[model samples]
Target: MEKDLAPKYLIHKDEKLYFAFAVIVSIIGYLFLIVSIVGFIVWLGFAILSMFLYGLMMAQIRVNGIRLSDKQFPEVFEKVRELCERMEIRVVPDIYVIESGGALNAFASRFFRKNMVVLYSDVFDLINSADDGELSFIIAHELAHIKRNHISKQLFILPAMWIPFLSEAYSRGCEYTCDRMAAYYTNNAEASMNGLTMLGIGKSLFKKVNRREYLLQSSQEKGFFPWLAEKISTHPPLPKRIDEIQMFVGDSSSSAFRRTSRAMWLVVGIVLVIFTFAGIGFLYSDEIEEAVNSIVLDANSITNDVSSDEDSTIMVQAVAEGDIAKVKEQLESGIDPDIQDADGWTPLMWAAQDNNVDLIQLFIEAGADLELQDYYEETALMKAASQDHVEAIALLIEAGADPNMASESYGWTPLMTAATSGNLEAARMLLEAGANPKSKDGDNFTAFLHAKKEGYKEIADLIKQYEDNVN
Candidate 1:
């Protein structure tokens, strides 16, 4: 079984398809050789020429102009190298750091003879400073691409890309396979998942994001609309990728088997469609080419409506204003709710401060993980109560907000927040929902003492009731 999974540096499934395409083209050339009555040697030359051209078509990179040296960024390169070694894979690809602060990206580029991994300088900086396992997981994920021959297969799919729908399906399958490979290289699921989160889904306070809750949220998007959207996508939606990582971090073989099965079915479907169209193409090859070209040209004219950056800013504003409709629009537009602005305030944090109960509910309904804390270690519940938002407090409490949760930096809880604010209604709701009245704040004052000192007699009464209930 281990041998079966033994990494092959050669052609992968997609690469095999490329070679099939090459063979098909070569067979057609040989048939021409028979019809033209050419000399045996000339006929052989044409066949060889067809084979060479086919292979060259799959080779997307022709020159190696970029150099990847570990010496350029010794610290990051050393860490990445160590991580690759830990994964037990041979042939670690060269690492190149490029100038891209605005665009955070990492990709396997193999246009030249040498296989390479190019990481944006900002991306390296963001991830390199992370905790121990995070750096390793990220590096391991990139190496998984090299070990699995993903780049080679990607190059092989160029011909199929002419078929718009099939090309989309093939590209998506490749992403899932690479995601599985990343999980395989890092035995730690949290590390692998967190790495992806930092790349796209997480913020600075990523440590508090509940992995289970995020996975559950992703699982709810497998409906017909989601499926149709996925069919037209280049990358599997971020949540689906997270869901895929969660399913396979501990067990690569299982993940690989499941992915392979799904890929096999997709490939079978594509092959059937190709055969159905191939006969048509053979009968009227010129007309088919013209039609395919027209479709491709029209596709190129379509404008991309991706609004990740604009949507992020709008989401922050909507949260600040407690605008449920605008927030929902941004979420559906693919803006990540957990993203923070220059001040490090997530959308949830902004909504909590705005004291908008309906907007907060909208975020929760859109699958925003409520457990995620801001950079200050303040959860949404804590934020709402801190600002004396009674309705927001009630909504958060009903949604399973942990009243006892304390910020590591500030060491404050919801009860302490309500006590300091002197909001009797908020205090009563929190206490009734199991807020620990005995919990102390940064000043080491219990909720009861905080309320009394703030001259809030009604707030103090609520704290006393909670204390009395427990006693």
Candidate 2:
């Protein structure tokens, strides 16, 4: 909401311009969404699939990487905490060091609200070197990117990335910004330069290279292609990066970065990407057409319907229709009282959901498992409470059903479910049956809090009374 504490010199010169264009591109996307719903749907589906694959990749890294903590890499862990305090970042992200075979690099990643930082094993070795500040510089650079929320911003600016050199241009500017913060926080221009050098060359000789001589040779190179190559790269060239840090800390006299018009290349790149996708679409025209037609014919169509097995199906139908005799017949015929459907729904769940107390008792007498959860981990007790089925709720509770059972998805206990519907009877029964009034759901809302939200003061007061006594 307010301006940040960081000084202006820490920001790249052209970062705001590129970010404004990113905002405009997002606006254009919204316009397209309004005029083209089908296109938006396709884009959304592709985005979801891509995110799922990305999550799996991150999970694999987490499983294989060694996490830095108090007991593991304690020095690095302490340094990171100190840096976070300097940056005013309250929550420190999970940091992991992975074996990258021989790669010397680090990166920031995220999924949902959780942030992660990964430092390669080779880069992690720099802590033991004379240029140990190089490791801190790299760590600070990655932390700066996380503080700026760059990965989430990438998703917001995704539409603009298709414009050929635009992605690289923005990325290079981001590198400049992050580099500035890293230098400012680490306060070691030489270590930062050496760190950038290690990225380009290898670990063995980066410490041996002369910084003055390398920058002089890089400065002497004069050609349009060299400038163009720098422009087209997602990261500024290593020498250019090193020079920028020198200028930042008042150790250099020249600007190491410049930007020129990329309009022609932008047009060319957009045309190429469109044609590439168009060609692939042509080759798979039939299959793609069928998929589109099916979606267009039924916009509500999402998941395929899964049918239940025969015994479960009959029991569920009998419960739905209040056919207790048929349910009894099935129970007497040696059917498993707890038989579940393809979706993991059981007969007791169906009976409780419909407030069919007779069938609930019949199933319980026939050895039904009251705690069996459905595909979403919803128990019969939760189902009964959600629908305000008082008789069914009492019957299940008397049969030793857990009054505090919560659903898998929302973490809502049976009392919270009952409070949401303003069912005082169900709430009273649940509370009297020993349901905890202090338990919170996924949104951090307790039954009392939920009752207060829906203007159910009676339920709220009742829950508050129990909450006070319990506390």
In candidate 2, which residue pairs clash?
none
Give lDDT: candidate 1, residue 275.
Answer: 51
lDDT (C-alpha, whole model) for all candidates: 0.61, 0.78
Clashes of 2: 0
Candidate 1 per-residue lDDT over residues 26-88, each given as its tens digit: 345446556776655674676579657754743432232233456565666676666567656
Q: Score every model by TM-score.
A: 0.41, 0.58
List the candidate 1 regions with Cα displacement exceeding 4 Å: 1-70, 83-92, 222-225, 249-471
Candidate 2, 224-329: lDDT as tens digits: 7876787688898888889877776778776644435534445534445443444444455445434534543243122212222445567778878999888888
The C-alpha local distance difference test score for the whole of candidate 2 amounts to 0.78
Q: List all candidate RMSDs to the true structure.
A: 24.9, 18.9
The local lDDT score (0 to 100) that residue 6 gets in candidate 1 is: 38
RMSD (Cα, Å) of candidate 1? 24.9
